[model samples]
Target chain A: MPAGDAFTPDQLYDIERAVRYAEETSGLHFSVYVGGADSETRPFAIELLNELDDPDRTVLVYVDPAGRRLEIVIGELAKRQLSDSSAGLAALTMQTSFATGDLTGGLVTGVQQLGTHAHQPPMLHANDEAHKL
Target chain B: MIVELSGHSLLVFVGIPVLVIAVLTLLVFASSIANGPRYRPGLSWWAPPVWINGPTATKPDPANLPELPELTASTQAPGATATATGVARTLGGASASW
Candidate 1:
């Protein structure tokens, strides 16, 4: 890892890959922020989510390892697709891995879970009504 | 008679053991030394910001969205009824049931 970077290249790569998978599976924006929060975690996470272009459709995962805090915030629209319970489940998975200091593994697994939970099957019937001969 | 040890004997007694110990230490720690330091909690982080789907990522930026209208405090009256449906329902009003 470079002097200013928090994660090694390999670690960053793994995290990025996990984010990609999460987005692909969920069709929602996924953003991860790992750092110390100046204030309360949940509010801070909400602030971060609001900074995005589309907070309503974005899911922000904030981890404060130093403070041992993990927050998963789903925006208004995102909450419709990913319920709070599902987010809590993902948080539990990440929390366990984080407690063990397996950040990469935890993130990969948690994000994968979120993606799976939010997965939507393609609608194949929209244009089929008029096509049946 | 006083006996003096030769330099070769001194080398075998001290130098070889030191060399063996050095090699053993290197063997024990070679992986860690190569991989560098591991992260410990509460320590200062050293990495830069990495945005996986950020502007730097290859994915195209989402099209610009229409700007939202600003809501000022004056626009919303105080003590208005807030509904659980996330809609504002009229409060302090009498209604006839159908």
Candidate 2:
């Protein structure tokens, strides 16, 4: 736990657990990056998303503690699944937590919301082929 | 000549060393206290990427992904292409389609 490291082991665990839960519920790829960005936060986040193999299907959460900024960038396909408004709401939730130095709590709640918003119910009529005939 | 060795004098001697010890103790730990929590950058990240309900195997590097077969005109369907799904779509207005 040295200074400038992304997060302490415990902090990382909590964030990862939250991510896991979000991914499970939403069925979307979730990535979290906590560090300072050399450029504008939004574009920097987009760059990070591009670094991933499937940028169009990934949701990346970027936090810049020193700059006191946060960005949640949803990829093209991800944006369709998770709207900007939904992401904004989650951002508000996380902003409150981060302001109070409660990064872990904020992330957990926000990620859960993302997951819930993206949850898709199973299609029950897929196997009813006889009706078509 | 009258000499006084009172309780006040004895208390001073004892209190002075206690204050000195407390100050010294604080000085020893002051650096750690001021530094707060810290993390090193560029090293292996603390936790592995957690992918819930994701592929059971480790996430493959993008560079390592096998090349996909190129779709050529010979194999392409007429006026149809693979559609990307799983993304939510928002429909505007009350337009009905048959």
Candidate 3:
């Protein structure tokens, strides 16, 4: 690993894979930011979320590793799929791992948990006559 | 009087200690090296920020992005949810600290 890099290539791959899995499972955009915030973490995280191409449907995970802070910001539309309580649960998972300095493990686990919480089971035989609403 | 180190003495004293020290060092640092750098609270951050799964493949210029307004008392009112991009947004999120 390089002297100043936040993650090794393997660690980066692990986190990216988790993000991909989350996005695939939830059908929502997932972004992760790891660094300090310019201001209060929440508003700064919100600004970061808004910077996404489709902010209304994205979920942003912002981590201030140095400050030991974490924020999970769900988009207006994405919140429907991922509730605030679910986000809190994911944050708690990350908080525990980060406490032990397992950033990659924390992120991967937390993102995977978020995806599971937001998962919407597929409707079987939606067009069948008996299943019509 | 001249004293010399035979192959047997070198192997017993220098070679074995060096091998054992090397093995111990590897055992101690193997996990951290494999996991890469870690962040300890209260330490100055070392690396620049990393954003994974960026919204776009290409990086957009920050200047073109809209600025978030100063958080005013009124703007934070229960029903005053909106974003800098003119999109009415209600943010749902959770915060945590170690």
Interface RMSD of each: 13.6, 11.8, 2.4
Displacement of residue A45 (Cα, Å) in model 3 is 0.5
Displacement of residue A80 (Cα, Å) in model 2 is 2.4
Instruction: Write candidate 3's Cα lDDT for A17-85 as tens digits.
Output: 999999899898899999889999988998888778888788999999878899999988898999999
Q: Write the per-residue lDDT of candidate 2 for residues B30-98, one digit (tens) a residue.
A: 975664454222222333223222323454564566656656666655532222222222211010000
Off by over 4 Å in 2: A1-6, A131-133, B1-98
Candidate 2: pairs in clash: A2-B38, A2-B39, A3-B38, A3-B39, A5-B39, A5-B40
- Per-residue C-alpha lDDT of model 1 across residues A1-133, encoded as one tens digit per residue: 2255556677778888888898998898888887767798766666666556665687788777666677877766776678777887888888778767676778789878888887888877767968666
**For all the predictions, what are the DockQ values?**
0.14, 0.07, 0.56
lDDT (tens digit, per residue) of candidate 2 on A26-116:
7778877766677987667666665565666777777666566778767656766787778777888877777676656777787787778
Candidate ranking (TM-score, best to worst): 3, 1, 2
Q: Write the per-residue lDDT of candidate 3 for residues B37-97, one digit (tens) a residue.
A: 7766566776889999776745466569777566766556563356764445677889999
Q: RMSDs, each prediction?
A: 10.1, 10.3, 4.0
Better of 1 and 3 by TM-score: 3
Q: Which stretches of model 3 miss by more than 4 angstroms? A: A1-3, A125-133, B1-12, B57-80
Window of ten residues with lowest summed lDDT in model 2 chain A: A1-10
Q: Could you estimate the TM-score for every candidate?
A: 0.69, 0.59, 0.82
Instruction: Report the error of model 3 at residue B68, Å.
Output: 15
The lDDT of each candidate is 0.67, 0.62, 0.86
lDDT of residue B84 for candidate 3? 63
The regions of model 1 sitting more than 4 angstroms off are: A1-4, A130-133, B1-11, B33-36, B42-98
